[model samples]
Structure formats: C-alpha cells, structure tokens
Target: MWHLYQFPLCPFSRKVRLALGEKGVSFEMLREHPWEARDEFFAFNPAGRTPVLHHGPKGITLIDSQAICEYFEETVDKSPLILGTAANRAEIRRLVALFDENFFADVTLPLLHERMKKRLVLRAPPDSKLLRQAMRLAHEHLDYIDWLVDNRRWLAGAQLSLADLTAAAQISVVDYLGGVDWSGHEGSHGWYRVIKSRPSFRPLLSEKMEGIAPPSQYADVNA
Candidate 1:
C-alpha cells in the first residue's frame, strides 16, 4: 500500500493522484493543509506542501510532485504514464514545467488564493483585482493549449503522458472555481473533455469541499 499526503484542491497533489490512478496504484489519501504548517506534516515535507508519497513496503518517502510521478514511472512496471524515446520524454517534461511553473504562477495560484484557499482555509476575503488578473492570464494559457492540440494528439505528443496530466490537473482546479471560460476554445475543451472522462479523473471530479461547492459543470465532461 501507498500513502499520499495531499490537500483536497492542490494542483500538484492532484497531478500525483492522477498518475497513481493511471498506474492502478491504490493508495490512502491523507488530507493535509500545508497552509496550516502542522509540525507532523512538516516532518513529512520540509517544504510544507501536500503530496508526499510514502511506499509502505519499501519504507520510502517521496516529496515533490514531479519527483514522485517520475519515481512511479520507474518503479511501477504495470502501467507506463511517461512514454516514448528520450527526446519525446524531454518534451513531456517541458510541458510539465510550462504548466507547473509558468501557467501555475500566472493563473492557478491567484485563482486558488482568491477562490478556494481564502474562503475555505484562510477564512478571508478574496482579492478581486488579483482574481481578475489571473482570469485574463488563464485565457492566454488556454489559447496556447488550443494551439498545441491543433497539431498533436496530446499536449506533449501522440500518446497520453504526464504533460496532459499536469495541464489537466491545473485546469481542473481552475474549472472548480468557475474560472475556465471553455467557450470558443473548442480544441482545448475537447481535449479536456476526453481527459475528464477518464476513470482516473472520476475520483477527482467527485471530490467536494465544504463551503465552496464547485459549479455544476465542473465535473461534467460534456461541459
């Protein structure tokens, strides 16, 4: 068995969850609010972030979402999420950085801070200005995705890979806050529709948080 310490709405945590589910790796999810910075949780991850994967049999603890996902790809031979030749895999890693770093800092973090964390955990008012800026930035990222899918079957390449999982994880969190304006971006929307319908993604859609219900269409693949 494996144990995953994660926040309910963290994109990084969700990425690891999708990778684990895609590989058919069953694990116990222990919810941790990194914002709270609990002493015990800090012991698990000095960064005070969610998503620390613990392998019971090996007695190994994995920190950082990207590192954990790569470890899963290497250790779990049953299913392969990161595929293709070395060069192809490099492209996958590139897009993962695109979403995890650039897209996340510009769009996901602001919306998450305003829409989810502030209301649910911080119990503070949202910064409308920051939220608006984040929304504007999100459209740019969506357009970029639309352009990418115009040529490739998947975000990184022909096959499903960590690139798609990473992008979807962030976008899904934004969708939960009703931040994604799916209209006019048919290519991006269609890609997300397929990803959302996957069995691995079903559990994520089913999740609900108190005091901050997701929009009705948040879980709907058709939407």
Candidate 2:
C-alpha cells in the first residue's frame, strides 16, 4: 500500500491526490505539515515537504508532486494525464508549471501565508494589505485562466490533462482561503465548476482544515 503525507490545504499534495484518484490508485492519507518540521517526516523527504508518497513494501519514496504524478503516469495504464503528441505533452507540462509555480507564487502562496499560516501556525491576525494584494493578483491569474478556457476546451488542449488538475488544485486552495473572486471570470468559473463536480475532486471538497472554515460554496459543485 502507498501512504501519502499531506495536509488538507497543500495544493501540491492535492494535485498528487487528484492524479492518483484519476488513475484509480488507492492510498492511505497521512497528514504532515512541513512547517511543523517533524523529524520522522524528514526521514521520508529530507526537504520536509508534504505529499511524500511512500510505498513501504516496495521501499519506494517519491518526493515532489510532478515527480509523483509522472511516476503514476508511466506506471499506470489507466487515464493518461500527460497525453498526446510531443508538442501536445509539452504544452501540458508548460501549463502545469505555469500553475504550479507562477500561479502558486502569485496568488496561492500569498493567501496561504497571510491567511492559513498566520492563523494556524503563527496565531497572528492576517494582514488586510496582504490579503487584498493576493486577491488582486488572483483576479489577474483568473483572467489568464479565462483566456485559456475561452481558447482551449481544457487548459492545455481538448482533453483533460495534468495542466487542468494542477491549476484547479492551486485554485481550490485559494478558494478555500476565500481569496478567489469569480466575478468577471465567467469562463474560468464555469470551467472550475465542471472540474469540481468530478469524482476525483469529491474527496478534496469534503476535507477541511481545522480552525479555518471554507466558504459555503467551497464544497458545492455548482458553485
């Protein structure tokens, strides 16, 4: 059996979970907060990151979301996420990196730091300035998503791929933190609703972070 170490709000972990779910791979969840810096967790991943996939019987440990997803993509014959021609697969990877790195840095990370980390780890009040900044950046990111949705059936192309999963995972975290503003981004909003309704997404919707209540619409597939 595989054990996945992750917290509810970790977008990278969420991405891995979605990929695993789509590939029909079942694993046990083991919550780990990297910020807590647990020594035992480090034994799995020296970087002390969440979403470490460990298969005890196989003695295989995977660190990094992209690495884990690719491992499954190669191993599992079901639901190929990084699919299509060389160029098509490149495009998928490009968009995945865009969301995983750029979107996370621009919108998701700010919200997590100002809202989640502060409230849970620091026990400090969130800064309105930072929150507003993150929300503003979120709108900009959403606008780009809107453009992508308008042009392509999926974020990368006509078929569902890792790009969509990666982007949605990051956006889900932002939405959970109440930093997303769906207004004026109807294209992206509609696209998100469809992803939210997928079977792979249900577990993520039902899970919650303690002491941080998500908005009512967070769990609602229609919203």
Candidate 3:
C-alpha cells in the first residue's frame, strides 16, 4: 500500500487526496505536523512539507502535490485523468500554477492562516500586514475566476481535471472558515457547488478540527 504524509487542514495535501480518490486508489494516511519538522519526515523530502507520497514498491518519496498526482495518473494505467495532448497538459499546468501561485498566496493562506491562526496555536501565526494584503489580493483573484467561469464548466476546461481538484482544495479550506464571498462570484460559486458536491469530496468535507467547528455547510457538499 502507498503512504501519504499529510496534515489535517493543508490544501496542498488535499490536492493529492482528491487525486487519489478520483483514481479510486486506496492508501494509508499518516498525519504529520509540518511545523515540528521531524527528522523522519525530512528523510522523505528535504522541503519538510506535508502530502509527501511514498510508493511502497520503489520505497521512493515524491514531493509536491502536483508532481505526485501527475506521477500516479501517468504511471498507473487504471484511470488516467491527465490530458492526451501536450497542449492540453500545458493548459492544465497553467491552471495548477494559477491556483498554487496567486490563489493560494492571496486567498487561502491569508484568510485562514493569517486572520485565523489563533485558532491553531500549533504553528507560528502568519504576518498581520501580509494577511491584510492577501485579503485584498484574493478578491482580485476571485474576480478573475468569475470571468473564467463565465465561459467554461470547469476552471481549466470542459472536463473535470486536477485543476478543479486544485481549486476545490483551496476554496474548501476557506469555506470551512466562512471566508468565500459566495454571492459575489456566481460562476465560481456555481462551480464550487458542483466540485464540492462530488462523492470524492466527501472525506474532505467531513474533516473537522479539534476545537474548530466548520460552518454548517462545510459537510453539505452541495453548499
């Protein structure tokens, strides 16, 4: 069986989880506290981040959620979610970068970790000023998504790809904290309603923090 080291609330880790579920692959889930930076965890990936995939066959570790997802989709022939052509792959990669870069840095990280870090005292609190800037920037990113969603069913394209999974993971985390401006961006709002409504999204929605109660809709899948 494969092993995935992840945290309870990291969006990057959720990306890998969604990919695994979409492929119907079962694996062991090991919860890791990334802030502590344990030596055993570092042995798997020097970056010392969560969501590291360990393939039992090769006993090798893969860092980065996107890399792990692509590896599984490419090497495992069961159900490939990747695009057939190089051009399609480029678009997928672009969408992934859009989420990992601007969406994450601007929206999820700031709203959750910054304004709400007090709820999770385990890690060092995020910078206050950066958090403020992140909130402003996130609205701009959401505005961009609103425009894109006006055209396509999915964030990247017509098919439900890892790009949707990527955005779902990020947005879901914030949704848990009641951060999304659900009424402002109808396109994005509708898209998330579908993505989060999926059967694969169940486990993510079911997740709950020790002292934190996700808004009632966090588990609704339809919300």
Over 4 Å off, model 1 = none
Error in Å for residue 203 of model 2: 0.4
Model 1: lowest-lDDT 10 consecutive positions: 75-84
Off by over 4 Å in 3: 122-132
TM-score of each: 0.97, 0.98, 0.90
For model 1 the TM-score comes to: 0.97
Q: Which one is best on lDDT?
A: 2
Residue 85 of model 3, lDDT score: 81
lDDT string for model 1 (157-215, tens) is: 89999999999999999999888997779999999999999999999999986678899
Q: Compared with the true structure, what per-residue lDDT tens digits does model 3 show for residues 24-102?
A: 8888888887877899888878988888888879877889988898888877776556765888778878988899777
lDDT of all predictions, in order shown?
Answer: 0.91, 0.94, 0.79
- What order do candidates take by lDDT, descending? 2, 1, 3
TM-score-better candidate, 1 vs 2: 2
lDDT of 2: 0.94
| Sequence-dependent TM-score of model 3 | 0.90
Backbone clash count, each prediction separately: 0, 0, 0
Worst 10 residues of 3 by lDDT: 114-123
Q: What's the C-alpha lDDT at position 61 in model 3?
A: 82
Top of the candidates by TM-score? 2
